[model samples]
Target: MYTSDPTPTSTLLDAAQTAARLPYPLLVSELALVLADPAVQVPPRLVQPLPGGARLLIMPALDANTAITKLITFTPANAARGLATIHGDVVVFDVATGQRKLILDGPTVTARRTAAVSLLAAQRLAPNTRGPLLIVGAGVQGKAHLDAFAEGLSIKEVVIASRSAASAHALVTHAQSLGLQARVVTNADEALAGCPLVVTCTPASGVVLSTLPRSDAFIAAVGAFTPQMVELGPELCRYVADNGTLVVDTVDAEHEAGDLLQAGLDVTRLASLADVIRADAFVVNGPVLFKSCGWAGWDLAAARTALAVLPH
Candidate 1:
């Protein structure tokens, strides 16, 4: 029997540092490769509802030699207590021996990998776009996306929109601290007006945008995973269906993304991120929508990347 010592643990800060060391393009390419492999297994995520509207999520992925599982919890009410809504850990193991290798901070890996994948789609679908990037939501994903874009893409300015003015302003301050020009917008419509790239990371149960986005924009909606919650409305879906293809991280999106479910989108017509990367072309010459509901394969990829950079 194969045996191993106890696994090393990495914190959120360590995960962030490790993720930062890797280039966005490389991360995107790695994800594309993983998704394209026929041998890689990404089963549907398991969900268990807890009391008080909280839920636990179990996501697992496996390749030939590596396996990983992420255990996360979503507590919407945590925000009232000034805590993060999502929290958990990712466990990585050796597939051949079933030996645990490493444990990583789940939220950090999720944020970084999610943002990186979004940027990947944006790069391919809207390569010529120059910002003024618009980011909706002032939470963890919001800040992480800001940092990713700042480091990976060229942008002249940034606009942040949130339900609360204080949250938006605080994110603006955070952006300035990073030496990026950013400001707060009063509403989503104002923020989406002329921005070439838009990212939504809120947790609103209903449609968050009050107005239609520009026809030439590339929108990345990362919030609203469950079928009952949505960030984008039917109008946006219709627009994309009419002009450009609606892109998703995986085929599982049809079952997990509330934005797509609420819009009654045709899953048969939606394009996967792997297909986009492989084709290296946009499905249309108009606005594109990329909706991601978190994938376990991403957690696996991120864990491998983080472990490579961490000291032994």
Candidate 2:
């Protein structure tokens, strides 16, 4: 029923403005519904390797009325050049007429949805104890997660850990500007100890941290989407698998998450994010692990919310 001669394009700033208008809880709830709805269709993502070890990923999802596709490129070598490692765009379409609806900045969509999803998991998995928050990697995802959690949760103290001390200090300064008590730590173990909530947002191919989190801590790893990259080590995975809940955004995560794949976790035992959202008796007994490899349905849901709030 909708058609346009030229599709409207939304910049990353526009997407951020729209995100600011939509409450975090609403965004998470919408994504949960899309994940639980039997009518929604999300096919497996397609991957293609490019020259110089870069890779292109295509993810498509459709509900009864709308459809969206996200095209992403991962170039690890770009980091050395002071560029973003991942970049892409999302295309939204009207299913009824097969007409283009909106095109959104992919990195912005990814950062917001990823953090929102992690917050949803943290709300469900994090213990009731009040402790310092630890964020590893001071990149876009790191900053996004900090903002998302700060908006919804009662975080009193924040600790930032990054390979670069300057980056960590800068993030701490940013957090302080937002009225958050924050500090920087060079040691991963020192940062992980006694933290009630932890989120890792790095693209490290090997284990980023070897320290074990507190028994009641909830950790969210948002990096290492491919089979060759990992942020959490095998010991951490085994600890959660043995003593706590291990949840992922989608069942397909077993194939995409390098941490889980390398950890040799039993895919059949992992629970989906939708399951956690829908379950009424869910409880975490110890440290909890929530791994997200990104999903097209989340991008579609975010774009839809943005479109509804954007001014005409």
- Reference-based TM-score of each model: 0.91, 0.91
Candidate 1, overall lDDT? 0.78
Could you give candidate 2's per-residue lDDT for residues 100-133 as a string of tens digits? 7767777777888899899888887788435578
Best by TM-score: 2
Worst 10 residues of 1 by lDDT: 1-10
Report the lDDT of model 1 for residue 57: 98
Model 2: lDDT equals: 0.80
- Scored by CA lDDT, what does every candidate get? 0.78, 0.80
Q: How big is the positional error of residue 185 in model 1, measured in Å on the Cα after superposition?
A: 0.6
lDDT, candidate 1, 1-312, per-residue tens: 112224544344455555564446666666776776666788889989999989899999987767889999988888778899889988878766777777777777788889988887877786346788999988889988888788778876889988768888988998898887888887778678779789999876667774676778888999978888789878887777787657888888878888888888786568888788678554556777888888898876776565455343
Give the clash count for each candidate: 0, 0
